[model samples]
Target: MIAIGWVKVSVCFILSSLLVACTPVTPPHTEYDWKLPKGFPSPLVPEDNPMTTAKVVLGKTLFFDTDLSFNQSTSCASCHQPKFSFSEPKKTAVGSTGQKHRRNSQSLVNVAYNSNLTWAHSGLNTIEQQILIPMFSEDPIELGITGHENEVLLRFEKQHYAQLFKDAFEDSQASYDKIVKALASYVRSLTSFASPFDEYAYQNKDGAMTDAAKRGMELFFSEKFECFHCHGGFNFTQSSQHENQRLDLRPFHNTGLYNVDNMGAYPLSDQGLIEVTLQNTDMGKFRAPTLRNVEVSAPYMHDGSLATLDDVIEFYAAGGRGQGINNPLKSPFLTGFELQLAQKQDLIEFLQSLTDHQFLNSNLNYPPVSH
Candidate 1:
């Protein structure tokens, strides 16, 4: 009886120790070595998705892996090439299996800071969620893995990928959510803040920028042109952004790209934000992408309608194609401002100044192939 009583006391002591240890202790916040360039604001990072070196490495591998596609043909780099600032030079991107996409692949530049992704769809919020649409969608199929999900997962279940999956995720088994997380993490790391304009404007270098670029900057910020209304901020993007930011939310705009049939109707082939909301007023409305690296991402606009920076300037100078005739959503601010030939050249130079050559040849290129 005495021995039994001693055993019960020992059990009680162990339980008491475990309870003391289990008392909720707050974990210390990890400090990331974030380097915010001059005039650049801090990027919004979700608390649940903290940045880690291992996560970023895994994300990078997933991003460049073509195995994510239906037939293991096209990777994210297939559409969003690193050379074009993560945008496709083609008006519409071709899928892994030679399927042509309807809309041009949007640039991933500064997308980490964007509040909403895509040209018009508000349904896409997080990069992780957005990656799935292209990976699994059927209508206007992107990666073409709709009916072959099980097959795709099985391919990834190989011993070669087992270690990669285990390292990236907290679980033993690889899943779709873990894939999305890795891709999103890699994309978020595609940050660019070292352009010539960045060195000149924010760094205050006396002669970092050319005289023409300076003139163009003046024109861009001048009240007459009012270019800053939509393209203002450190990132040169309209306000759409995520948390940990001090800026206002971005609003989608219809820059009078079209008024087909003399009515306020955009082409059915590409109906910007109207696709998701199904509202007439939302027709031709698209999120204003950042002008950073704008010069290289030519064939401008969502449809790749504009060909060159000069042509873009001319389009904006004329306030879109319709002008003041039948378009309703045309910004009242754009009143067809007159720019001289010299000023136009200067503006183009300034746009070119935003290009970061280093980013174009980044190591994010496709992995080396084996013989």
Candidate 2:
């Protein structure tokens, strides 16, 4: 599933009220060095599972270890590989036993900032809670840990894991709780802010972006383009929430992907949020993922139906998918746009600038050497 696909520095700090502060800022949790980029706020973390070096190490090891799977055939990296911005090349996810998933596996980049989890769920917010679907859910049987929980857990009782457990939880024992907590910690650590856009925007390095990319950036933020309405903010998404966030904006939109009855109904296999809330208005709705590292994390959209960035652009330019264009549930922002050939290429070049090579290192996917 892991196909080929995918840092810069920034300065400038803002003080409370009117003054500007250049003082070194550190996140409240000190054990883990977030290494956050300048100008970005500290990520909101849950009090129950404070991030730590030991836990991150344990989680990273388990994340890549296929032994964590029921059949030892899959790991978290199977669906989310580091090379593809923590996403995969497959159109959709395939479980350990080759059970096909209903929706596309979204890239996990900057997931810690997401206020909502999954493609449509409004309630599943935390990384710890969302991870349970893969680790234990019997529906699609991702890790297939439901029936074989004890057997799979016992595998981690070895001396190697014993030390890891002890260092992380102050006990030489492993449990589902420890595993979930550690896995969440590792995932929360994945933050990308070294893109050319970051350097140009945050560090004021004008030379960081190409001339065409710069022009495209202007168009992206312009009101006429309206791209920033959903994919806005420092993270390039409206669904983000950081430490300073006060508004609980869990925005989901219907991009008019389907209209089988001319009633804005998406495929029954996966109709987005309507499945959970059972609300008619929520039909064909899905979360707009962060555009960071969007260059590599393709075959896009909730169903992985769009094959390329150009296709996605055309979809938006034409308002929506053919029949769905007239769906009443479609976002008002998707009214359509006139895109010129030159403009399309320029927009793509800007998207390509979002790829962060430094963040795609092997350390996030490969396990450390056994002691």
Candidate 3:
């Protein structure tokens, strides 16, 4: 009886041990490893489309796959190239069907944090919605997927993509909703935070930036330059949001890029946010893009009018371009400021310091197979 009682106690102990061992050591979560820079918070994610490694893999493959296009002539990378930090050198983007877009392709670096997507469209608050314009906008005919969506969907039904879809969505069926979600996940993963500025500012590495760049950084944040008003914070723009910050300012400003009619009016071809809102007060208003990878993604402004960093600096120094200087709707911060030659060089150096080579050189930035 004593031996049997001892055996029962041993069995109970073993069962309890097994139960504890079988339990998860750490809590299970849907959180993704963003590999974000120190002190940088994770980007805000949609509740419906939680990020996962499988989605990233599938989305990355689709981002570069020309098969997603109806004609297979152009892919997302055609406009947003990896070498240029996902923004091409073109003044304006040309669609798959050879239709021309009005605005330049914005860089995708750290785009996940942008409060507003695109330059002037206030309605386009999400990357998933912005992506649809390129895929199916009949007026611009970007990927020309409007009528051929069925055809394009059929192409991804192959075995290779089937497995990817299964892994991403637990279903092997390829649909546009899943495609957009996957692509969004891939774009969200395209972050750049390894720049010299990040080192000096965030990582406390004093020697990362040069003296001139450091001086320029001070000047950039100073009241005299007033650059921080529009282009400020970690991402260097007011139109930014993250995990800790729920501020959806969606700030847009009229930098007086153009004033054709001389009545605070932009050109008839493109009038910025006024067209969307049909409000004259919103004339020439556009979202201020993040300056994270500005050095690599050249040809500045919404129209890509300024060819170089020097030209952009000069444009702001002179107040605006052509008649845009005297425009009534220009931002209050656009008032011309004096920048000496040495100071200009310093500012340029500081802007260049924002380049992130690590993010640019990552193999993940490249297509699965060379395009």
> What's the lDDT for candidate 2?
0.84
Candidate 3 wrong stretches, greater than 4 Å: 1-29, 239-250, 363-371
CA RMSD of each candidate after superposition = 6.3, 12.7, 7.1
Enumerate residue pairs that collide in model 2: none
Every candidate's lDDT: 0.76, 0.84, 0.85
Task: Point to the candidate with the largest lDDT.
Answer: 3
Per-residue alpha-carbon lDDT of candidate 2 for residues 101-188, written as tens digits (9 for 90 to 100): 9778889888889888888999998999999999998988899999898999998999989999888887888899999999999999
Candidate 2 similarity to native, TM-score: 0.88
Better of 1 and 3 by TM-score: 3
Give the better candidate number (1 or 2) by TM-score.
Answer: 2
Could you give me the TM-score of model 1 versus the true structure?
A: 0.85
Which pairs clash inside model 1?
115-240, 115-241
Q: Please write out the lDDT profile of model 3 over residues 257-352, one tens digit for every residue.
A: 788888899988788888899988899998888888899898888888889999998888888889999999998778989989998999999999
Model 3 misses residue 298 by how many Å? 1.3
Give per-residue lDDT, candidate 3, residue 343: 89
- Clashing residue pairs in candidate 3 are none
Looking at model 1, residue 207 earns an lDDT score of 87
